[model samples]
Target: MTASAGVLDELDGIRWRERGSCAADPDGGWFEDLRAPAARRARSICAGCPVRRKCLAAALLYGEEFGIWGGLDSDQRHPLDEALRHGEPLGRVVDCALRADRAA
Candidate 1:
């Protein structure tokens, strides 16, 4: 489903919503960097987060423009959010990401 701003509240009943690994991180400071090393560390944390998918969905749904969510940096999330906003199918966005990854 396409996501919109403040949609995370609708997921309150989802257990992962309360189980994000970064919940206790000091304002999620570690996720703000665009540097490769910092991004790697942040992604490592997200990789272990139970709520990784939810966090990513929330970010994409809301057009979050900062920090790492669901193992993705803001740059990685941009096209996904754009696709969702434009009513593109989710699979198309995934395929685009895969193509970009392969190209890189």
Candidate 2:
């Protein structure tokens, strides 16, 4: 299998949601809202999440078209998702997006 496919396969077994900081957030609305303030809050919560990369990978794999994942809104993740769809390594794309998120 290709490296990106393998990465996605590995991601399948991980219980990332159990480890995510958002798991404890009772107000899950922040993640689903497209408003700037809510999106920012969701991203902030994701910024400190241990499973952020996995979350992002899953979002890309599933073609999630809305909300925030891995500290990035749909628009932010679109380019990375496209790169992955175009056969980019999942690890490379995820890591780059995370690094950019950190730098921002």
Candidate 3:
């Protein structure tokens, strides 16, 4: 999905989280667990999430160093975080990561 201005604006707070695919799941640990199986499950859920870009943007913006956000774990998001720190636009970086995710 394109990161429109309205969507970007919504990323300012925790409100966007309500729409995440993982929001309703009782076991929130799947996203934060270092175990491979849990991470796989989290990524699978993130794959179909409608607010993935928002999720990733928020994660990067807030320096979330743990958990799977927008289908990407900490390791996958590290470079993108570095890019953001280097002055890359948050939207652009998120879009690139999502594109690469789809291609993979």
Per lDDT, the best of the predicted structures is 3
- The C-alpha lDDT values of all candidates are 0.66, 0.81, 0.84
The reply for model 1, stretches above 4 Å from the true place, is: 1-17, 27-29, 89-104
Give TM-scores for every candidate, taking all chains together and pairing residue i with residue i: 0.63, 0.82, 0.83
Residue-level lDDT tens digits of model 2 in 1-104: 88767776767865768898988984764556677676667778888898998998888878888778777888888899889879888788989999988997
TM-score of 1: 0.63
- Candidate 3's C-alpha runs over 4 A off are 1-9, 32-35
Give the winner by lDDT: 1 or 2.
Answer: 2
TM-score of candidate 2 against the unseen true structure? 0.82
> Cα miss at 22, model 3 (Å)?
0.4
What is candidate 2's CA lDDT for residue 48?
89
TM-score (C-alpha) between model 3 and the true structure: 0.83
The model with the greatest TM-score is 3
Expressed as tens digits, the lDDT of each residue in 1-104 for candidate 1 is 54533344554454665688877663554565677676666767776677666677666755678887776778888878788779885545644654464465
- Ten contiguous residues minimizing lDDT sum, candidate 2: 26-35
Candidate 1: worst-modelled 10 consecutive residues by lDDT: 2-11
* lDDT tens digits, residue span 18-90, model 3: 8889899848555556676767777888899998988888888889888888888899999998998898888
* Backbone collisions counted per model: 0, 0, 0
